[model samples]
Target: MEQKVFIKYFSGTMSRGTRGIVFLLAIALLAICAQNTQARVTLENGVKSKVYLSPKIALHQGSVANKYYYDMEFPKGHIAIKSFNAEVVDEEGNPVSLKETYLHHWVAARYYQRKGIKEPKHYGNLGFQQSDHIPAGNAGVCNSASGLSQFFGLGSETRKTSTHVPDPYGIEVGNPLEIPSGYEEKWLLNVHAIDTRGVVDAMGCTECRCSLYNVTVDEYGQPFKPNYAGGLYCCYDETQCKVKNGLESVKRNVYMKYTVTWVDWSESIIPVKIYIFDVTDSWQYTGIHDCLIEFDVEQSTTNECMDTRRSKSSFPIAGDVVYGVAHLHSGGIGSALYGEDGRVICSSRAIYGEGNEAGDESGYIVGMTTCYPKPGSIKIANGEVLTLESNYSSQKSHIGVMGLFYILVAESSTTLGSPVQIHQESKVPIFFWGVAAFGLAIFAAIVVAYRRRRQNGDGYHSIAT
Candidate 1:
């Protein structure tokens, strides 16, 4: 566009080149007029769904850089923006405001499992039934994240949909290395973030931070970080965080080894927890330990960063293989592995992202899924604090859904003004008249008659680019 202006302006000054300059101006005017005829939808900055309180919503972010990648900073009341290409019409056939609206995204979802617990009843019908009362596999169902897929949905307070897109960086995992004494090697992770139609606000964004610990190098490709996020919050502090530019830095130098707590063990039980939603009937998560499963680790490494094996992988007591699930929260994006001992292991770097909102809008994207020594030998621990985080740049709070709308507007028009306010509807008639006049000018310059799109409605019927 700038080059075109230069040509039109400079060439017009010369006498002999005046005709060519006029021709270029005429072409530009026709293009301008043609766009005005089709221009309609206007994308805004920030527009997203609100935080759902009832029934709870869960957000899971794992691994900021490597598989354990996690490096996102989120504040309360942050909005998300998503863009699409379409027109929205209301029930009365009226176009609602296209500007993006500010929305908040948060996570709090409930899991329902059935556990059988014999409560003190009037008739004394309380007993552990293995052959008759409860069903099979009731003893192995401790995790229920996949079951909550039905209740997944985002909401909007107003009757408007987003038409803006923010730059998003995606991560993919690859290749595993296993060693007996220690593990060492650099792994590869790929990332791609698309540019938004508007200027993206990536404030307070740090590189994806991750840590690898409680590692076990028991089997090839089967190495597990028993505890996700380097044994939860125990081995982590503010000082452990490192920042760099771009997403690839998130996955470098990711490995762990430890000898502390020589054995790793975990269990998850849906012990009969009754919710008195009603008087006669009650809702429960598990049917009396029906979802009870546990996994145990026998060997692990003790060396922190340099060692790839968790010292605990060599569990002292040769504990039985107990399998249960660990959490993959929204803000935290990464993978977990079980050490040869009974400990948990995680990546060394955190997952970093640049967006208006974190995983709330994306809704707890999956981090990692690996098979332990035995597929069903792992178990989730009891009374664990919910630590899933969608950590991102502090910009998430300020950008809001309005920012996405702004991006959409940018994508819609090359000349979209700084303070993007769409042309008024009534002025559209005058806009069309001007377009026709410009088209006639182009026709004169090019020595060709311009066909009226309103009458022909044929080719070249495109909206503003």
Candidate 2:
């Protein structure tokens, strides 16, 4: 009986030792798994980000620079773009205030240029008509010739806007299969800036009032209609706004400092198509989308002081909306996109600056709100009639105002799948998790065995006593 008790006690001690070792081994395995999970996630989500400066722009008091920079330095090779943000900066990389230099608008366009051909002297004129140049614009409902074909564009509100494409969805570009033979992909940047320092009317200059610039003809020397008061035509390159008499200001060089974020294209990444809607779209009347990019807001005639414009058009394709945002100029109150059943899909309001800093320049639009709907919640059916409504405070007449909506759509939600599926596809390698779970199972089994051995040892001691 004493020998039996000794054997039982020995077994209990061995079991306890085994349990402690198993517990430590389990903890160590979990730590290694956590490290492995992090490393795996870093590898799978290989998002690369970089900031680049555009070709230098020279400006002075009341001067304007509306230049198209072709073959601008950009990320090379096939990739999925995640976000693009830009701000005007001086030569020293300091952010420039909108009060000093108003950013009218900046457009980023994609194109294909045939190899062994000289680049066009001006992309705005040749556009897609030149034999050597092919405009690779967004999935559009607007006429490409109307200058609304850009994949990305923003006005003074660029600084505060959110352009990030969420996880698993991206803007796919630079695919070799899509590029035409003997042609290479290229990008174009159009920056229209107006220096308002010492100007007679800063807001008028920014609005491109023809009187402020003292111009009757456009950049191409084309005559403007007698009633055409102001717009982009009045604020072309080399044009100058009326300045204060004898007010001296030195010329300064500035650049559009742009940052791009993207990830290398992979099978797991779902591509999204970009579509831009214009409130001035006349599709129902013209049978073709004629997007008048700008319009004039006449002052109120009575007590009502709001100018509201609405346009309805059928969505050309069926897809799920991933993200949306509006591009509205100064004086814009808000804008909204509606579905066929009058459901509000998305709405964005302007955020005006109240200070004198670069992003917070007083009385200037610093940023606009954005929309990110659930993966499959907001779906646009093919041929679905959509309405766009834009409102502006009509306290006084304003020209060159814009109301545009941009949205990114995915073909289907299957690619994104359920949240659990997205996690499984993007990160959390099955093999590693399986190993961790196996380790836990073994640890649990050892615990149970230790408890049984202890109970048996206790019974044997009781009998011996």
For every model shown, what is its TM-score relative to the native structure?
Answer: 0.17, 0.80
Give the per-residue lDDT digits (tens) of candidate 1, residues 74-193. 111211222111122223333322121111111111111133433222211112133212211111112232111111111121112222222220011111221112221111111111
The stretch of ten residues in a row with the least summed lDDT in candidate 2 is: 417-426
Which runs of model 1 end up more than 4 angstroms from their true locations? Answer: 1-106, 110-200, 203-367, 370-376, 379-465
Candidate closest to the true structure, highest lDDT: 2
Model-by-model lDDT, in order? 0.23, 0.86
Candidate 1, residue 380: CA error in Å?
7.6
For 1-465, candidate 2 gives per-residue lDDT tens digits of 997985465445456666566567767777777766543323244676667888889999999999898988778898889899999999999999999999999989999999998776763545577778889999987988778888888989999999999977889999999999999999999999999999999999999999999999998889998899999999999899999999987899999989888777777788899999999999978778899989999999988999999998889888889999999888999899999999988999999999988999878889999999988799899999999999998999889899999999998544674221122234556447758686666656656676666888688432355
TM-score of 1: 0.17
Model 2 stretches with alpha carbons more than 4 Å out: 1-45, 121-125, 418-465
